[model samples]
Structures are given as C-alpha cells and as structure tokens.
Target: MQATPVNPHSSPLVRVALLAYTFLIVYASWYPFSDWHTIGLSPLAYFSEALPRYWTFFDVSINVLGYIPFGILLMLACYPWLPRRWAALLCMLAGSLVSGTMEAVQTYLPSRVPSILDFITNCSGLFIGILMGCVLTPWLLQKDLLRQIRVRWFVPSMSNGLIIVALWPLAQIYPQGYMFGLGQLVPVLSNWLNIYLGIPIDLGSFIRQGAQLSIEQYWLSETIITCCGLIGAVLLFLCLLQPKAPKARLVTLLIFICLGVKSLALALLFKPEHAYSWFSPGAQAGLLVGCLMLYGLAFTPARVQRHLAIFMLTISLLVINFVPGNPYFTDTLSTWVQGKFLNFNGAAQFLAILWPWLAIWFLLHYQPAKSTNPA
Candidate 1:
C-alpha cells in the first residue's frame, strides 16, 4: 500500500512549534526548577545526585518527555519530503546530537550536570515524536485546521531557509569557547601570531590592553563570519538543488574548500598547534564521509543516503565506545561508573571522551538539504 504524502503547506506551524520546543528545552535545561538546594532537600540527596544509582524514573521521564515534542514537530516539518521510515532514524540521530550538545553545555552551567541517562531520554523523546507524527499527520490532514493554517503562512520555498537561519546561532554553541561570535577568535589568534613570530601586529595587543578594537578587526571578523555563513548556506542550498544542476555541486565544493581554508588560516593564527589537526586521518575520514553524503544527496534518487549515514554514525559510535586506547573505553563499565557515580562532572568527563567520535558521527550525517523527491 502506498503511504499518503504530507502537505508541504502544513510545515510552517510545525517548524515554529519545533523551534519553540527547542528554545524551551534549552532554557529549562539551563535553569532547573527543583534541584536539591532549591527544593529544601538535603545536600546528601540520594535520588537525583547519588552516583551510578541515579537512574531514577523521574529523571528519565523528564528528559524523555521534554524532547518528545521536538521530535514530533521536526518529523512533521520534514515529513513527506523526508522518507517516513528514515525520518524516525534521522530524528533519533539528530536527537542524540542535540542531547550531546545540551550535555556539553551543562558542563559550564553551575546548576546543571551532564548525564548518559539524559542522552537516552532525549533520544527516546525523538523516537516517540517520530511515532506520533507517523500516526497523526494523516489524521490531521483530514481536518480543516491544518489546511486553514497552511493557507495563511506556509510558504514552502522559504520555510526551510528560515529554520536554518534560526538554527545557525544554536550550532555556534557546539564549538567550545566560542562566545558572542567567531570574532573572539581573531584577537586571540592575532596575539598568538604576534607573540610567536615576533611580528608586531598591535591590533590584538590593543584589544587586550584595554584599547577598543579598531574597525579593521571588527570588520575583518564580521567579513569572515559572513563568508562562513555564506559557505554554509551554499552547502545547504546544494543539497536542495536539483541533481540535474551539476554546476551546483561544483559551487558547493568550492564553498566548502574556501571555508576550510579560512578556518585553517584562523586556526593557525589563534591555535597553531591545532591548526593542522583537522587534517588528521580520523578527521579527514569524517570529512570524506560528509562529502560523500553530500554527493549522494545531489545524485541519488532514492533516500538511501539518509539511512546509510545513520548506520555509519551508529557504527562509528560503537567503535569509539569499545576501542581500547582511552582509559574510559578500556576500563570496565562497572568500575568506571562505581568510581564516579551520579556526578555531573564524571559524566561530563565520560562525554568528553566520546565527543570526538560523536562529532565525526554528526559530520558524516549532517544533512541540511530538504529531500523533495521521495523514494
């Protein structure tokens, strides 16, 4: 039996809902309402704070429940455009990325601590959302409310772009130590370059020495950031472009290379030690996989690329989890948990160990393109 297709017109509200839910989760995750201290509970709180045994139903429920709407709305927004079965899988992968980012951010928050259980719960919420969308969209289409809403505001061509623009700032939160914008990296890099090479570039020193940054530094940073944004937009545009336009592929590749060069140059000035690190074999492999995914998006008619990316990510994660090099990986799970049970700091350390692989996974699976032609 052929499945019914979702109306693209129905997507704007769904997108808005998804965005709202994402905002709420981010806000709530940062500001917990009922921690032990706030709730007049003991500092020796055992239920939520106890190590290893901290797997309470309350925590699980909250985490999972919080993300369910995110998953459902994302699915609704992408539905019929994204393959239905693949939508669920993609949601799970995306959910994991969001959970991972949220957990990473929690490290900096004084009140919040990261946890594996949260990851599990967030992913589960995405799964539930996908389930709900699969079942609910068809029924909703039979009603007049969705159609009425769609008529007023949903413009298919612009909706996805708007969503992407909204998400750009959120993506910035992933790279560590980046605050305000990429502008911050310039001064640090300028200082490093001036110190190491003994070349007197006073711009960096001036900023640090309490002198207001000259228009040059500010404009340069803004220009670089604007270029970076354009590169990213082009890449996404390429994904959505018709496969017949081979020129789009070339353009996207050029944009990517340009951005890579720009990033490398900035890194050299700011952190020379890590500037070439992106070229390391593991990182290169991830890059290759990402390129391949993009190529698939351009050329493939079937939606297999999405599933393939998900599979690759899952396999990569499994390898990272079980590989022997890291002490966390080599140590027995029981021993590791016993040593730092229920502590956010410990969970954060654990996450840090796995983050490289997780990053690689996202790179491999990151698809900004809307799949218009369904398999």
Candidate 2:
C-alpha cells in the first residue's frame, strides 16, 4: 500500500480566512468609529483598572465566541512557517496582543468601555481555539477527507474567491431593501456626508430624479436585483470550481444557504411570522429565473462564466445602490429589535453593503492559475 501524498504547500485559504476574520474583529471592536476623546489617562488604563463591576455572562460569551475562529485560523496560518507548538504559543500571544490593543484604544471612545474581563475572556477563547486547531489541523491539511474534497473540487489557487463566496451567506444576515440585494452605498454615503460635510444628500432618490416608483416598478427593480445578485454570487463560486465539481449540488446549496441566512436574520431581527416575508413574488420569479440561467450556464466555458459573473455583479451593484429604498422594507425595518446585537448587526450590515463590491473586484482582477476546467 502506498502512502497518500500530502500537499506540502501552505494553505492560502486558511491565511485568507485569518486575515479576513482579523479585520472583522477590529471593525466589530471599534464599531461606530466615532466620538473619540482623550480623558488625560493612559491608553493602558484598562490594564491597571480593576475588573469591571458590571459584566454579564452574555457579554463574556460573546467575547469568547468571537476570537475562537481567529485563534484557529491564526494557528493554521502559522503552520508550514512555524512549528506546531510554536504556532500555538504565538496564537495565544497574538490574540492577547490584539485584544489588549483593542481595549486600549476603546479607552478613548466615549461609547466604548475598555475592560480587563474582555481581554481575559478573549485570551481564553484563543486558547481553546488553538487546542481545537491542534486536534483538527493535521487531518484537515494532511491526507484527509476535507483536503481530498478541496483538491478534487476546487481550483488549487482559490484563496480570495473562496473567501468571497463563503461570505455571501453571511452578507445576507443584514436586512436589505430587496432580496439578495447588497452594496447599497448611497445611504451610507448620504449619512457620512450629512454628518461630516453637512450636505444632506439622498443619492438613491437623486438617481430616481424625485420620481415615485409604482408597485410594478418596484417589483421589476427587485426582480432584476435579485436575479443579478444570485447569478453573480453563484457564478463566482462556479468559476473557482473544477470541471468535475458538483455544480448543480453546490449551486443549490449556496442558494439555500443564502435563503436560510436571510430568513433567520429576518426572524431574529423582527417577528418570526415574517421570516419568509422576503420571498415576495418578485423574489420568487427572480430565484426561478436565476436558477434556470445557472443550470444552462453550468457547462459554459470557465472564461465566459467569469466574465458573466463580473457583468452580473456590476449590474446588481448599480441597481441595488441606485434604486430608492422601498417603503415596505422601511416599515418592516422599523419593527426590528436591534437590542443586544447592535454591534453584530452593524458588522453584518457592513458585510452586506460591501460584499458585492468585493466580489466584483475579485472577479475583475483575480485569474486563477488553475481555474480552467479540465474535460
């Protein structure tokens, strides 16, 4: 019996995941990014201050749960560079360093309170994550089931593309004006201008030229947005996959995952009864059409698929950002309870608003060395 050959190269996917998660951690920690002032105390005041008098199990759990993935990814990323034991130690130290820096900076933010408890809990999460990674990394990166599947299905160089595709479902966690609609920068830009430049601008409405859209117009806009967004995201993934990959199964799974995330987000943010409210007639028609389009394009040339992905993403981004906000969606948003998950919702909104843009960038510039499908 021959021993299975394990790829000796470092996994780019793990490295990309580590970097992405680190960015998310930084963004989530300093959410809102405003109202910074120095209180004449050292930034390290949190280090000397006693434990926070007010803390909850939920807060501690959230802190812990947040850095676990970071720790695992960091450990794996250090692999093929550093020894396993060293990588574990470095992961813990790096996690503590990052948490401490975040806490130190929070001292200047009026809305954020730096706490030692958070630092400790974050370290604990990193420790746990390192241990878990130790147990799983060998099997995953070596000759294991997951490694086999990845090698067999996906292109060898798909670090960036894979990350973008994986984040698609997560981007749907934030409520949107239309189903599968994302990258609406108009509102975000408008708010920024209003705050900083005192220029009250509604870019979306400006694009509409003060014209009110009828019910039919809204439906048409939504259907176009949904179809384009779905095709863009699914085809982006398809471009990364090998010719022999299970295109149908994977595409269906991706759509279902996005739908499930969107439904769960709606239920959690609003009422459970309204979970499937996004499944409007326009969305249904869009989904059907998108599915049919993808089925036909499954066997298309990889280069054509990549170009179509870029084109679809560009269309979705333009339509989603230019279309005025839907009144019905506004009313539904009014009912949302943004209580404990304010920071989380903010991060999700950031992802939703930026995902399509990132996907477009990837599609435009990233040409995988192995993206060509082998017959």
Candidate 3:
C-alpha cells in the first residue's frame, strides 16, 4: 500500500501577505481617498460601458502587474486547506471579485475612472499568477527541500518576522532624507494637518524651534539615522535566525540588497543620472560603522539582540522625525516623476512609513519557541 503524504499546514505569513497586498490594492485604487461626492452614476455602469477611449500599454501593464502578486499569495494561502484545482478556482474568483469591487468604487471618485478593460486585464493577470503559483507551491510548501531549509535556518515562530525581513528592502524603495530611514511620521502628519485641517504647523520645524541646523549637523543626523536603522534592521534579522545560521553572510547579503533596491528605486523615480546619489559621504561612514557594530554583536544572545534592535529603532525614529529637513533632499524631490507610478509610489511610501514601526512591534512581541519541523 502506498503511504499518504502528510497534510500541508497553513502559514500565518502567507495569510498576512495576502491581506497586506489586498490592503495595498485597495489603497492604491482609491488613493488620495478624499472628495466623496456622489457622481449620480451606477457603480456597476462600468460592467456594460464601452472601453476607455484613451488607453496605453502602461496602464494595462500596471493593472495586470499589480494584481499578479495578489493572485499568487491568495492561492498559496489556500493551498493547505483545499485541493489544488479548488484553490486555483478560488484565487481566480477572489482576484476578479476584488478587481470588480475596486473598479466599481472608482466610479464614485472624480479623479479615478472605472474601466472594463482594467478589470479584464486584472483577471488575465490573476490567471497567469495562479498558474505560476500552482507550479511552485508543491516544491515550496510540500514538506520539501525548501521547507527543510526554512526549518533549519530560522528560529521557530517567525512567520511575521520573516515577512518583516522580506519587506525591509522594499521599504527602502521610497525615497528618504537619510539612507535607510524608514519611519519619519512627523512631516507626513504635519502635511496632512496643514492640507486637510487648515492648520499651519510644521511639526519638525516646531520641534527644532527655528534653530537652523548646520550642514555639519545635518550630516551628523543622517549618519546617526543610517547607522541606527541599518543596525536595528540587521539585528532583527539575526534575532529571528537560528544560532547556526550564517549571520555574517546573511547580513552582508541583506545590506547589499537593500542598497541595490534603494539605488534602483532612485533611478526609476528620478533621473538615471541621480541613480547613485544616495551614496553620500555620511551614508558611507554610517555603513562602515554599522557593519563593524554588526560584526561585534554577531554572537550576542537573541534576547539581547532583540532589545538592542528596539533601542536602535527607537533612536532612529526620534532623530529622523525631529531633525529638520535637508534642503538638498527637498531639491531632489522636485525631480521625482510621479506621473505613471502613482499607485506604486503610494504603496512604496506606505511600506516605507510603516516598516520600522512594524519591525519594532515584531521584535517586542515575538516570543521564539523551540525549533521543530512544521506540520
């Protein structure tokens, strides 16, 4: 008699990934979520409406690319609970339903136009994504080599920690005044208050109280933010990894990957001529100091690492938010092209704004358990 394979288990990471992507989709679709006056048109009118008169390959591609990950994540989340065929069907239905709902809601927004073509393109992406997921899921989650590797490398109960690590590079995609600075909420909040509430308050400036920061001071602030941010993020990764894991190699890879992501994002968002602009003198010094710190702390206890990560993150946040804006960084922002990647920019900004907070939360609350093979 043939032996039956053990039932695959669901991962909280997969479920959280699906939910996070869905939130991004909703946020991107209805971005700048203001001005809610009714247009007196049926939300479903797009179902029967003609294709948009003016459309471009870029729009179609964006619509498709946006939801491909949604489909892939949704199907992966379903794989443990349902048969493959059923999961595939459910992913298609869920992706289409989400696309339809977003389109319908867009009818109410004057800035956004609901389009049948977008819906069709989104469904096409979902179908393609589901196919890709089906092919990859077996080897990825079926108690296989990948599963064994994950089990061996990471500590137990790190589903969310892993997700945070994965998103660290992505959070760097959004431009920041300081390299690796992830959470600077005061300026964003100040802008929102000024724009929507008619309040004229620059919180960062208020905190500085008209004291003009010198070029040397600004450089010092940037260096502090960069070093603390990198150290905190790398230590978070180390805390989640097993004692036997390759800490130096993984940390090296992560730092390089984050820098590459930042460079590529800058190139895409600004002119290619400014691709390496983030490699400032302060950033270089911060990177060097952060690496030396990480090397020394490589063998620290996971609990100590977690606490240090929180402390570093807290210091970075305080400095980045209170420090006055750099004049040069403000000038660079004027060159950013937000025309085509509005949704992408919004998503990246969202990730950048929230990533550090999420990491700190994970580090504070995550309680590692004895390592064992996942069911």
Candidate 4:
C-alpha cells in the first residue's frame, strides 16, 4: 500500500503567511489609520458612480497586479482540502470581497477616494491571479512538486523559510536610508503613537543630524550596514536549510536574486541610468565584508546561526537608525509624475519597513523541539 502524504493545507506557515498578507492589504488600503470621518456618506455609493476619468496606467496596473499573490497563496492554502477548482473560485470570491470592502471603507477617509474603477481593476487583478493559480497548481501542488522541492532544498521543519525568502527580495522595493537596512520602523511607529495615542515619544533619531561624517567615516558606516545586512539575511537562509542542502550554490543564487530585485525596483522608481547608483562606495565595502562573514558562518550549527543572524541585524539596525540621512545622495521622491504610485509606494514601504522585524520576531518565537526535523 502507498503511504499518504501529509496535508499541506494544515501548515502553520501557510496560515500565518495568509494572515500577514491580509493585514498588509487592509493596512495599505486604510493607511494613516486615523481621521476616519463619515458624514452622511454611504461607502456603497461609490460603486454606483461613473468610471474614473483621471486614472493612470500605474494605478490600474497595480490595482490589478497587487492581489495576484493573494489569489495564488489562497489557492495554495486551500489545496489538500477543497478541490482545486473550488479553491480557485473561493480565492476569486475572497479577493473580490476584500477589494469591495476596502473600496467602501475608502469613502470615510478624506485622503482616500472610493472609486468604481479601482474596485473593478482590483477584482480583475484577483480574477487573473486565481486563473494563473489554477493553471500552475496542477503541476506545482497536485504533482507534489512543492513537496519535492521542499524535501530537496529545505530543512523538513522549516516551511516558514519559503515565505521569508519569497518576501525578502520584494521588501527591497521600498526606498531605504541605507542599502538593505530594512525594518527601521521605530521612528515611524513612534510618530504614529504620538499622533494616535498622545504618547509623545521622542523620535529625533530619524531627524537629528549629529556630527557630520567625514567622507571616509561615511563610507565605512555604509560598508558596515551593507555587510551586516547582507550577511544576516543570508545566514538566516542558511540556518533554515537541511544538513545536506546545497549551501554555497544556494547562497550565490539568493544573492543574485536579491540584486536582481533591487535593480528592478530602482529602475522602476527612477531612471534606468540610476539603477546602479545605489552601489555606492560604502555599500560596495559592506558587500565584501558581509560576504566574507557569510562564508565564515555558513557551516555553523543552526541554533548558533540563528543567534548570529539576530546579533548582526541588531547591530546593523543600531548603526543605520543612529546615522542621519545622506545629504549628498538625491532621491526622486518629489519628482513622481502622477498620483497612481502613491498607494503602491505606501504598501511597499510598509513591507520594507516591517518585514525584517517580523522575520526576527518569528525566529525568536520559534523554538525547535528535540526532533531531528524543524517541523
């Protein structure tokens, strides 16, 4: 008799990933998180309004594209329980409901508009996404390709790594004060607390320009930030893998993937000419040091590797947050030609500023049992 495989739908990784993404979608659609004023305005009224005349390709495209992953992930999560066809249909329905609810809520916020066009585009995006998921799941889920990949490439217990690695690159889509120094959400959090709860926490670390860095000092600081950031990310990936998984090769692949994502984000946000502009002298130095660090630590015990990842991240965060923004480097923040990018920008920023911390928290919370597997 053939043995039955474990149900993939019961995975904590999938459930948590779904919840995290849902939270992000909700938060982005209702950002600023306050100033909610609904003076005799029915949120549903926007659905009956005419199409938006002032929409741009960027807005429409993002609206359609942003929820694709939700559909894909939702379908994946529903597999092994619901039939594949039902899962895809349910994903589309859920996406439509989320889009509709977000659109309706937008009516209450002065900063956001409830647009019929946005609603339609959002649903359209979800539909395409679910359609894609339906096509891909046949080979990916049903054929047990996901299981094969996981068994071959990852530590059996560390399914969480899939979500982390998948998100790691995309987190770079948001602009950062330091290259790859993500999860610097402290100042943002402080500001929100002060405004929302009258906490009055001092958040001057973000703005207080202390002693000016000598040209060399600036480069050295930048190098450390880059090195620590890269090493921490890679080390975490290494720690999550099975004993026999390919380390050196996978590390190289991960590095290339991150670089590609960063390059793509830079190109899309600014001119293609400015894509490599992020490769500053400091960042270059950091990359070398970080790689050396990764080489040394790659074979460490998994528990030890986790400790090192946390330590490196803590040091990097301290240095990056303490240092003020570079005056010499110019950002294209004010030059955005249209309003279409605003929502997308906010979502990416939210991810970039929060994912690292969340990753760290997950690592800290996870205590492996005595079993040989991470599961």
Question: After TM-score superposition, what is the CA distance of residue 322 in candidate 1 from its true location, in Å?
Answer: 61
When 3 and 4 are scored with TM-score, the better candidate is: 3
Model 1 TM-score on a 0 to 1 scale: 0.35
Candidate 1 clashing pairs? 51-341, 51-342, 52-341, 52-342, 189-270
Ranking by TM-score: 3, 2, 4, 1
lDDT values of the candidates? 0.47, 0.84, 0.84, 0.75
lDDT of 3 at 356: 93
Question: Distance from true position, residue 54, model 1, in Å?
Answer: 2.7
For model 1, residues 277-357, the per-residue Cα lDDT tens digits are 324333344444455545445454323433443444344333322221212212322222222222222322223233333
Tens digits of per-residue lDDT for model 3, 315-350? 999999988887888999998878867767777888
Number of colliding residue pairs in each model: 5, 0, 0, 3
TM-score for each candidate, following the candidate numbering: 0.35, 0.89, 0.91, 0.86
Runs of candidate 2 with Cα error greater than 4 angstroms are 1-8, 48-58, 144-147, 368-375
Clashing pairs in 2: none
Better of 2 and 4 by lDDT: 2
Q: Of 3 and 4, which scores higher on lDDT? A: 3
Q: Mark the 10 consecutive residues where model 3 has the least summed lDDT.
A: 1-10
